[model samples]
Target: VASWAMISNFIDVVKEGRGTFSIQGLGDPSGRGRMISFVKAPARGGDKEAKKPAIIAGTKTDLRRLSMGKAEAILKTLGVPAEEIKLLTRWNRINLIQRLSTAAAADGSKLGDRYGGFA
Candidate 1:
């Protein structure tokens, strides 16, 4: 089912050269979760912009919590340098927040006035 598909994708990503990955939720408070690892793909190709790494954000309560460990192991097995593996614990939700703000603004109504917050 969906699990199988995700596993397949993970394998494919590992086989590919130089990709960034982010794992989330090893441990955190506030019930907000945290990022566990940041895998930086090796430098390849001439295009600097193309070198942008991939991100795999995970949360503590996520169903696939074990994925973080699995991903790290696989990357290591593939001979990815140790320096490429970094542990991080931040969730980047700016995109979502910006989208919500944009939508609210587009409605031509002030958020505080419409939602009854501090003016």
Candidate 2:
């Protein structure tokens, strides 16, 4: 929930026009698994009130690993400009366990920062 909140807030900031976007998530596990969400930012006040689809993707059922490729795909699907989307991951208890179990456990690439900008 924390990571998703951060991502959603970030997306809201970069989407440009206010009150022009809607955000949603798919594959979210409610209370059990990881939370994933999509941010849809479209131009406002069109000829008609066109509804845009909300793109969705999320972590696997285990909630320990998140695929950057999948995350990128979801952002693309939601029409997020490539240069304006940032990715942030926060580890919960399950993630810590998974990281410790791996023999090659010293990789700190994904742990680079708590906040980053895709721009």
Query: Estimated TM-score per prediction?
Result: 0.18, 0.20
2-91: candidate 2 lDDT, tens digit per residue: 778646655665664343224433333454445533434445534586665432222223332446555544344434565644433433
Model 1: colliding residue pairs: 20-54, 22-56, 24-58, 25-34
Where is model 2 more than 4 Å wrong at Cα?
1-64, 86-119
Q: How many backbone clashes does candidate 1 have?
A: 4
Please give, for residues 2-77, the per-residue lDDT of candidate 1 as tens digits: 5574455456557664354434332222235554233333345446665534333421222223244543443344
Whole-structure CA lDDT of model 2? 0.40
Error of 1 at 68 (Å): 1.0
How many residue pairs clash in each candidate at the backbone level? 4, 0
